[model samples]
Target: MSHLAIIPLLLPLFTGIFLLLLREQRIYIKRTISGLSSIALIAVSTQLLCAVSDGNILVYSLSNWPAPFGIVLMADRLAALMVLTTSLLALFSLIYAMSGTDRQGRQFHILFQLQLFGLNGAFLTADLFNLFVFFEVLLLASYSLLLHGGGRKRIRSGLHFVVINVVGSSLFLFAVGILYGILGTLNMADLAVKVAHVSPENIGLVKTAGLLLFVVFALKAALLPLYLWLPTAYSQTSAPAAALFAIMTKVGAYSILRVYSLIFGNEAGPLANLLDGWLLGMALTTIIIGSFGLLGSKRLRQQVAYLVVISAGTLLTGFSLNSQAGIAAGLYYLPHTTFATAALFLLADLIVQRRDQMEDKLEAGLVITKQKFLGVMFFVLAIIASGLPPLSGFLGKFMLLRAALEHPALPYIMAIVLVNGLLTVIAMARTGALFFFAAHAVDTATNTYIKQSEPEPLKVRELLPILSLLGLCVLMTLWAGPINSYSLETANQLLDTPAYIDAVLGKEAQ
Candidate 1:
């Protein structure tokens, strides 16, 4: 059972190395290998999740060394669940890319595999320094993937994304250095124990380091004031890449949950509740900004990108409450948002491909082929993204809102969330009307401007991935009871930081 902890990290690392040796022309071989590896990852992550579901924490130490001294990987329910979610998203994204998008670059397969490797590593590692290492690995892969199709807009957005992250990475290193210098340890479990015992005089420095780390994570999570890069960058990227990048923001949310719950949590004395006011205020503002962005977006992809921001704000709002119920709701909301957002990205690309010359613009154009099928898909996704009833989105938001009622800031958070949902519905409805109904104007245009041709029908290969993602959202709605149960249990485990520490560092640490 302990050995299984390393398989998630190793699977992608070895596959990525193997892919580097293959030539660019061997597209079929590359696709086969990538697909099989992704399936294997899904299996491995599921097994790990089941193993940890019994409220057990599995730890694997490298080279026979242990605790605050050597590298370690820890898998608890939250980590395993996150890994499984990531694998599922990766598999579908890879399938979507194989429909001719992978040809835009020479080493798409290799970069994709490396991205998985980094994400898995970041989730599994129990050391802060190694977390930084994995972050860089993933960012490097994403930078290349962002510019894969090589358009001027993509390149320009990619450059901004890269520069901002580079600065974030530098801050990450500085924070880690400060902590290591003061505490003489980088292992999370050890740091948790050491931070509790820090002298009062030096505690200020510890708080500063912890807050700096939060800033770094906030940049990744696209928290307000640091989220300007996401809209342009995500809107301009290839569909498959944008779908996969959905999980990247969750990585930051996961980090915030882990670090705050374990290290600077109630056990840290002065550091406890350090993030409450700031995180909550910023989160509500983020929701408003995202909602306004969605309403003002002029392109289909850009609207979806803003939806991503809205999801982030919702998740962070739940997390900021810093209670078990709130965290559980956030956990339940995480996977639902991930699948829905990814599906929208793929669906947008399909819609764009079917248009004659308008190409995803929010204005009238030639009628799309497969109009009924696409209309149904768009409506279903809109409901899911906008938190309408009969879908998981509504259920998740209900949980969050119900949990928020117990907090002191209930009125503020609840009002913002409700308004955001209303704005989202309006934006989605207007966009759908423009895409499906406004095409009637084409018949009235002058003869010189007339351009008529039957749009291409949707392909099975392209449609499969979108349908799979939507099906997942429906499944989530059907199984909400069990999923929420697991999320609640996961939250219980996270709040009980002492058990996590003891599991990783033995009984003496507790």
Candidate 2:
């Protein structure tokens, strides 16, 4: 009965609505409102996490309706963690936006809040159909945000993004329709129960629906074949949007983890482990492709985009193991990649801002102001992204590899992951050298180092958000012990299917 589960959804919902009603000219007020709302979101999400930290599954039935009939907002450790991650990222992204990026579009604040609303709701919703609704909400807000600056690159990428997601959304609805028609319930807990006992005649339809859901989630997660739309869309979008999008791919990974484990899990009789065979192979392929993309990228933003793909592939690989340790490793790595990738995007933009004509291209450009500071930041991020020692990325990847030691495909998993890490290291080193070390005078005879003009002085306010994100990565590394312990507990809770079912549908139903 705790209301905390619903607050994460409601706070942003109302905040977005209020921001929409305000006049756009009152820009300062709008920024203040949006910033405060994001801060409040962090607080509320923290409370929700604390509430569920003790193995509690807090479910709030809409309108006091009972299970399987009512729409429910369920906050378990997993959902709470995701909500918190989204909130933290949103706040930092907003701070970065406030540094002039928000001016690039109309109603930036409103759309930002709406996007948070959708993200928070998507994490907390317990019903399958409501999940689709939240997906649309987030996608709608993202379409505008992606094209916020209004340029040819953004438009082209936005159109591709829009078309792909629309098709994915259609697939999601079709899958949901099949599930509801056959199972008579769209509540995930109920579906889990019903899917286990599905009659033989309907098994084919159920399997079809399940595979369709997997495809939709993979498309969202940007798994290979369906990931064609992500690099362009993500790399071309504004920095703040790109940074916020660091968590977007994780949503697909999260859905795959949730739906596959809960509904078609080991207890699903014939449908048990339906996706197990395909997930590992696809995940490895995704990693390989992403590694190649990193080497192939000609720009910093695009390289960062490919890194996101690799992270997703790694995450799903862990989940594919279907073991507690593997899932725990993925959970720990999730936030690390998110923070690190986002920091890189923000930093890339900062570097591009000072390069004048060169932007983020991986070619020699005029040396930027604050070269020393930016160089150090990029170096730290590079180490983290490449999964080098003493960082959260390394620890997370280590745990995953350790967890996979017993799997039949251990060698392949290790090979792909380790090789990807090496490629990432090479890519990062090359990018850093080009941006920081390769700069030379534009006029050799005159020995002119500056661009048409010296780039604008670097501002502390602009660096603050990027630094904050990096600081989070550092803290995550320092606090790995407790964090990993928590991840393990969450993994345990996730694998405890009966507990989840009983909590949602009551012990009688289970």
Candidate 3:
């Protein structure tokens, strides 16, 4: 009922438009505007989160229109959490870009704001069709961002990224069309009501539509088979873009959780548990593939990119459990992985810049400037990324493992999760040794790495973003109990389909 629900979307929408008009004028001016806007978003999102923390579900009906007829923006705990996470991630990424990456491309700030607009809209939307609209908004902005710093590698990766997403979009439209044609509504709560009462003759089509939507969400989430494009796209993009994209896959995860738990939830009779075992199977395979990918990667960026894949799998594994504890575990793990992996991306960018010509390749290169500083940062981030003890990562995995103990596939899940963690540690250690230790070895025969003068000092500004993200991981670990309790509440709220439908559709409809 409150209007604040729409501010997250409007703020970014207007800012992006304004920045677009001011495009290429004064770089510093654009940075200031973008930075302030990002900060504002964080404030507004934080307020929204606090407002909804007490189990309040605020719905903003556009133009005073009611549900199933007009567009609506709903802010429950899950939506607020997502918006806040996106806001935080965007701000840090923008800060990193201002260090120099923004200068590498035209309209970087404009695209950044637009992507945020899309991301916020996606998280708050109450309609499936609107979800598609938001997806396109974010994807369009990401497309430009991916190619921001033009290069052959980026061009190739962007091409595949575009084609695959275009196909996904097409499938999304087709599914939406089918659902609307049959059910006569695209509003999610309305569809939930209609789906349960679907005519037997049309149940097949309904299920088809539901599964199609899953395919689109899975593609976005980067599930096993559909995730082939992620590593290359993330690795080749500019560092800031990669960091922001850390939350993009979570969008897919959010979609699956939202849609499945609502329209196709336990109340859906035949459609209940539609994604049941399917998600767990795909998630396990995704983790395995991602682990091997991390081990085999020759570049730091690619390794970080694969870590994203592994995180996605881990998240889905918890969500697929279809239990309160499991979903809570996934929600808790979500922010941890996002922040950790994003820190790694930013760290990788710094390493690449300081390595002279060696870039992020795993091979030994010239001794980087501030090797000790960067090395320590890498070591800490590595432990975090690999889910080692005493960090948010370990707590997240521990919570998930405990949750899965009651599930049927406990053995497979436990084995894969444990092995993936081990492989991640090994890969990170190896990469660290090559980049920090091996590179420092003076080729006594040739003294190739021996420099006559010390390299430039590391910039504090450039390090801020990575440190900020890592700091968040530490905070998450420090406040694990309160955070996990909140997650449990959020999960409980999510599974209460009747309440959601009642809120969106009104009590009379229910």
Candidate 4:
């Protein structure tokens, strides 16, 4: 069972290599292979999640070597859940791409699989250097994916995105080097143990390395000042690619949680709470900026991009509280926001495609195809995005707010969250009314022009992916209780440093 830790990483790795070997124009074959691999990943990840749900940590050491000296893959509740989420998103996004977007570029399937490979490796790796390696793998794939349906706008945004991430990768290397030099170990579990015993004089170096590491993760998570690159990059990418990118930010948040809780957590004498104040302040500022961006966005994809920023802010806000309850709330909120944002991005694409020349500009134009159905879908998604009643978003936000009340930053965080929610509602309402309700020119039966119009219905392929994602949101709402319970359990597991160390390095280490 412990060997199962490597399956998620390997599934995508081999699938990507196989995809690379296929003929470029063999769309059907590529789609079939990608779909099957995604399904298999979902199955494997679900099993892993179930296996680890009981507080078990499955660690696979490479070549029969021991921890702190050998490469290892570790899966607990948190990692398994992240893998499941990534697989779910990958499946639907691949389906959406098959609808037509895959034709926009060569090697779409290959890049998509490689992206998953990177994501799974990042989630499962127990070594810091391997984590950096996985980051590069994912970043490299993303650079190509961002330019998939090449356009001038995409090129510009992709250039900036690539430059920023490359710099971030450099910083990651520097941080890893500092840790390896000081601690003589890069395995996360070993680092956790070693960090607790660092001499007072050397503590400053460790803290410096930790802070630099936080900066890299922060850039990935799109925290406040570091988030400027995200909106344009996300908005300009192809929709399916954007939907997959939805999980990228969560990867950053996951890294922070995993690294901080294991290495610099409560057990790490002087390193504890080093990021609390900075994280809280940045999270609040991110929410404010995202809200303003939402209100100001002129394009549909751009608005959705800001919504991603808002989701990041909400997750980080919960995490910055640094309490078990707060962290659990963040974990619960993550999937809800991820699914909802992905759905919105796909919906934006559907609307844009149907509008012909109008695109997704949020202006009065040609009547959208499948107007009635899309109208309802957009309405439901709007409610979800705005954190309105009877959806997972509302419940997630409620949990975060409830948890925040106990924190000293409650006033600021709560007020900003509420205000941000209101702004989101306003922005979404404005967009919905423009796209669904605004009057458009129409041709009558007698061939005369009129000011009223109706839209064409959507194809099943395009509709399926959007509806599937929305369905997940509904399922998440219905299953919030068990899900939240699982989140709490996962959070407890993360905060329990001794158990993780002992699981990886054995009882003697603890």
Candidate 5:
């Protein structure tokens, strides 16, 4: 289709570089540039939904180089949806962050924009090597951003994130090299074609490499056992930082989903079949573990971290179905989980900060009034996070559970997920009990800062960002049709490798 498809990637890339060139004292200009760039990015991503919704995959090759030599960027229904979700989240997060930050001044915005560039590039790039490049671009920026405020705690977590990713990046490189050496191409489309020709023995080796590579994804997605890094990092970072990060793990999940379908598909080459077979078991265990974590935890921030595991489990369960309906449900649930899980974490962060401020003030014998509006904001976010009906989170789970029940194996799995959901409801109830229902709200309510008497409980600035995000959640819930339909269609596209294979490699040899 049109080359405009690449704007999602280009806009952020140049904007980030431009910001880097600013003088040492242009924080306002930096914020302005970032804000405008973000608005432009959002606008571009939305226009794409309308442009590509009519059943066409937009492909733009970089430079004048043809398919195999130059990098290719594609805008399919799936990719556009992801880009749109990421852009909106980034925009809201930037808004929230701008209100309060002790960052690298303007550099903070630069890195944030850089991070967006990488995310957009990852979603749009058609080449496997290119995908790897984009993943690093984002990951490195994230590493820097995570430690932006310069705390020993955040730095500690940032190091873990960096070291682990370095390992994953190494593994990914090895996997790509193996794939290209075997398949003679690094283009995802090219590999999709040449994959079948590698003998059964070779396919086994390839699958081994694939699984190795997938482990990297699993680690990034914070799948069970591999999920230790998230809670600490999210907890230590700023609300906006945590909020933006909420979307990062999903990128890993998205990559794994694509790789699983593209290379192995239904034919299920050696190692791929095994992963295909065991995904349900892994998902089930992840859900059980995550729910139990939430159940055992009293802290709201910790509970939200556990919820990340819950979403991963849910997405994995959908992928495990391995059927059209199952895949469709997984695809449909991706954005819903992306929004709900991350937003909940953000809301939790905000609540905890307010509570901490009050506690500090009370210790100094200052009386403070709790803001009614902030309480209401937390209440609304809590309900949505719990997957209650009239919320998109509920509809996502509903679709997935329905899909799971249709499969014989999935019926039992769905039951477990149901239990998981109940546990989630309980964890959310605990948050409400702790924050709203307890004697604490009444006995310890305070708008005053411990150190300063004039501090307000809930400033309008703090309340509006979250409210706007919550509004988006409502819109998604109310209009699940458009999003759901596109997800289902994209799922169809994901399951069938031939169309994608043909796109990159042209027709296969007879």
Candidate 6:
């Protein structure tokens, strides 16, 4: 019954409602409210992380009914960790949004809060139906945010985003409905209970439902074939919007993590044996397709978008491995990707802003010729994106590779890893050289920012958010040890479902 369990969702929900009233008021007031709300969320998430780090599952029942009939919010180590990441990223994006003024401020902040609420709810929820409810809330806000400013590019891409997700939601609902029919419950923990006695043959129903549900999650996570909507939808939107979308896909990954490990693992289920064959095959195919897309793409934005496909594939690889080590690597890498990719996209937004200033023709090489600081940040991000050595990105890849090296076809597996690594490096290197070389060659961009370099040159406030995000990238690389250890714990908890089930229920069997 701790109040801390729900603050992540509540703060954003309250801020969103309040922001609606301030729609026509002063921007400062709206900014103040948004900033305050984000700060509040960060405080609460931090408190929960501290409180729950000792491996406690904080469960809250909605309206106090009980298991099968009641709605519940469950916060374990993994959920709390995700809440912390979501809160931090949201705070940075909100602060960035507030510092830069625009016509979209009110609408932007409102949708932003709504998105947080959706994410928090998804992470915290214990019921299957409730997860879908939160999913819709998250995507609905995303649709509006993507379409903000009503640009033609945004409009087309937003429609694609909307149509694809709508179909996903429909599929999610069908899965939920079928599960309810079979088990007579929508609560995840309760399903885990009733599933043990549900006759071996009827388990076919559960496995089928699992496949259908995986499709929906994969669509949202942007796995191969189903991920076509992500690139244009992402590239067409503004930086702030892209920052938020990056975290959103992680929610889908989280759902996949939860479902595979809990329902289909070695926890009294017929589906346990089937996970390797179906899931592993899908993961391998996703990697093959995603790596090809990464190799073929030339633009910075498109390259990153394809990498999301690759990350999704990585997630599936960990899932398909079906071992604690596999789960550990997947869990560790998932959040690392969330933070790294979010920061990278924010960096790219800054690059695009600067590049946009050049108007494609380069204005006689004046606009982009001499911005040294921007060049450094761009290269740093490129390295992070490529998953080269000594970065958090590399840590995840290394663990996955280590775990996979034991297979019979170890050489082929290593080659796949090698090829993917090379492709990422080459693609990122090419993008970096284009800008860094240009920056060094151009004498100066001082005169280009304005007709003349004034005494107090105007600050690029638009870049502050991007820099703040990039700063996080450096912090993650520096603090990789602590982060990876915690993620390891998260992965351990994910693979060992007994601890999770017990934490949610009573120790003495009530």
Q: Each model's C-alpha lDDT?
A: 0.91, 0.91, 0.93, 0.91, 0.75, 0.74
Stretches of candidate 5 off by over 4 Å are 102-104, 267-274, 357-369, 439-457, 508-510
> What's the TM-score of every candidate structure?
0.98, 0.98, 0.98, 0.97, 0.92, 0.91
Model 5, C-alpha of 11: deviation from truth (Å): 0.8
Candidate 3 residue lDDT tens string, 242-357 = 99999999999999999999999999988888998799999999999999999999899999999999999999999999899999999999999999999999999988877777
lDDT of 4 at 206: 92
Counted clashes in each candidate structure: 0, 0, 0, 1, 5, 0
Superposed model 4: Cα runs more than 4 Å off? 442-456
* Model 6 root mean square deviation, Cα atoms: 3.7
Candidate topping lDDT: 3
Q: lDDT by residue for model 1 over 126-187, one digit each (tens)?
A: 99999999999989999999998799999999999999999999999999999999999999
Error of 6 at 211 (Å): 0.9
Model 4 / residue 146 / CA error / Å: 0.6
Candidate 2 vs candidate 5, lDDT winner: 2
What is the per-residue lDDT of model 5 for residues 228-318, given as tens digits with 9 covering 90 to 100? 7887777676677777887788788778777777766654444344475566777788888888888876466677778877888788788
Q: How close is candidate 5 to the true structure, as a TM-score?
A: 0.92
53: Cα error in model 6, Å:
1.1
Candidate 3 stretches greater than 4 Å from native = 441-453
lDDT of 2 by residue, 1-510 (tens): 778899988898898889888845567898898899999999998988889999999999989897889899899999999999999999898899988999876688888888888888888998999999999998999998999989999999999999999999999999999999999999999999999999999999999999999999999999988888999999999999999999899989999999999999988988998997899999999999999999999999999999999999999999999999999999999999999999999999999888877899998867574568899999999999999999988999999999999999999999999999999999999999998888776766576664456668768767888899999989999999999999999999988899999998899997
Badly placed stretches (over 4 Å) of model 2 are 443-452
**What tens-digit string does per-residue lDDT give for candidate 4 at 19-117?**
888856478988999899999999999999999999999999989899978898999999999999999999999999998999987789999999999
